[model samples]
Target: MSSLDAEPHAPGADAPRSPGPLLAIESSCDETAAAVIAADRSVLSSVVSSQAALHERFGGVVPEIASRAHVERILPVIREALAEANVTPTDLSAIAVVTHPGLVGSLLVGVTAAKTLAAVWDLPLIAVDHLRAHLYACRIAYGEEAFPACGLVVSGGHTNWYDCPDAVRATLIGSTIDDAAGEAFDKVARLLGLPYPGGPSVQQAAEHGDPTAVPLPRPMMNRPELAVSFSGLKTAVRYAALGNPNSPEVPAPPLGERRIADLAASFQAAAVDVLVGKCDLALKQTGRPTLLVGGGVAANRALRVGLTDLCERRGVRLCIAPMELCVDNAAMAGLAWESFERGEFAPLDCDVTPGLVRA
Candidate 1:
């Protein structure tokens, strides 16, 4: 039986419209993710296959390997999502995919899969911005929260501020002049001989390291503009480890447990201070009462705490996605509902834009 006739429908009332069932795919980076979502922002099924093991030895994600993993896992992930959701292709109204601002090879996998689904099933194609997908995680997290708030997206590859008018429309308000917050975290983690994927390792070590043990400069804190500079902070961390600028590389001196913890506290404090400061400035300029933060860095416990405290003091409500959705995942790709409803579809001529900019 056809899907329409499978479910009972009221006469003359178009077939019962369940929330738009959207299938979303995200391969903008090392993670291969797919999800089935309903129009009301209900996540039916979410699946993510990470490529950390493949690239761990390489320090970071290798585009070619990431693409291969996506190609192999794409079908299985989608199949699993559909099975978990108990939904079929015929039941889906559209397919959404992240098409740009990532490894070209990685982005192509999702885009190709989405286009194939759109063509074979006559489904509408929804092209989602990778960064915007990060912000949409906030929407998924806080269903009833007011939108059009400011967003601070921090990730391994990105650090930027935006005026999010809505899920689909975002304006770039500020961005990094050099390294991203996550990149800096990773670099500092390496400098400290922490493990790969530096954010967490650094957080863990910083918990025991003395952030105040070494005085590090906070970049661009006094700058009048929204632009940020983490390159300097990264250098400071390097100097802290190696001592003098021209000196040979040396191991970081042992600090007492409390001292190590203080260093961690201090490093986190410096990063959090700059982030909070910029976000506060953005909120004041936009006059938006709500602030939303997303991206991998949003998972940082310190950042979350610092932002929350800052927002509380300023009377600005802050909304952040749970840790699960904060990192790269297709569940947040559910924002396709907005694009589908608005009849926004990209042309076949669309190509992968590796360096796509939101600002």
Candidate 2:
């Protein structure tokens, strides 16, 4: 019997039983996270152990390092989450884990842990898609009123659009053919000598500079399909900053604070334009009156402002997940509740799909 149907009380019992909390784990990337969420959509506790520092020197996440870190942190993170929520394994209604579209080793860390817990505790296991969880963050933030919208997951590992008819189903509509928006940010930041995890750094530097000062190409802005391409744009930034690498080294002038700021601002503006423009197309194609934006890049202030303006002009409802939920976190995996409600539990033998996505 499913956990949802495992209530012990007889039919028509005088006292109704409260739903047990669901334990969700997310180790899809560099962040190791766990959360306790009730069936009523209450997030009791959310804990994330980020490997930003470990990956900072490398400029991006290293799969082996990330997976090893997840192995070390997953148990502690899950323990803390349950403790914070005042719930134990016995108090859990089910165990949910992101099992797809991530570094294989990192995914195994979480999947193995979840399966172990599920087996030991005899709890139901629910598999969640990482990208869907990002989009589902909006639903978690806004409740049932947030769906029937266009969902975009723009982050370091993904840039994909979806037609979300409700909390449980998402139809993939468009995606990036090259670099993800957040990856572009990181590359640009590296070229400008900024810190790793470039989204925030670029946003900060752009504040003091003129966005129009630098002219960068906006790739795929006029493309026929709803797809986006950032590789060309990234190449454009490289040529602008370092000059033609194919040609002899002309003594290029140093990039001063002002110049770097302008480049950051300009690149940010161009990227935001592409994102907002694609969102416009998605909204039109799906006829979705609402637009839901999620993933790490959703935390960009400029992107938020641009999206807000676009939605206002188009008369579309916009819901951006809070900063906490914008990044990879298990709290967003509260999305598992949807599967739990439908009694869609995965067997212990279910394995991870490293690069899974809907067609």
- For model 1, residues 1-359, the per-residue Cα lDDT tens digits are 43212332223545656645988999999899999999888999999888877876767677888889999998888888878888877778788899878999999989988887777666678888889888889898887464879988899899989997767778999999998999888777666666778788778877765556678788888788987888988887666655665765665566445544555567777888899889888998888878989999899998998898989999988998889998799998887787887888886557788995755
Q: How close is candidate 2 to the true structure, as a TM-score?
A: 0.94
What does candidate 2's lDDT look like per residue over 92-190, in tens digits? 788999999899999999999999888777778999999989988888889899989999999999999999999888989999998999999999999
Return the lDDT, model 1, position 150.
90
For model 2, what is the alpha-carbon lDDT of residue 138?
Answer: 88
Candidate 2, pairs of clashing residues: none
Runs in model 1 lying further than 4 Å from the true structure: 1-19, 247-264
- In order, the Cα lDDT scores of the candidates are 0.81, 0.89
Model 2 clash tally, residue pairs? 0
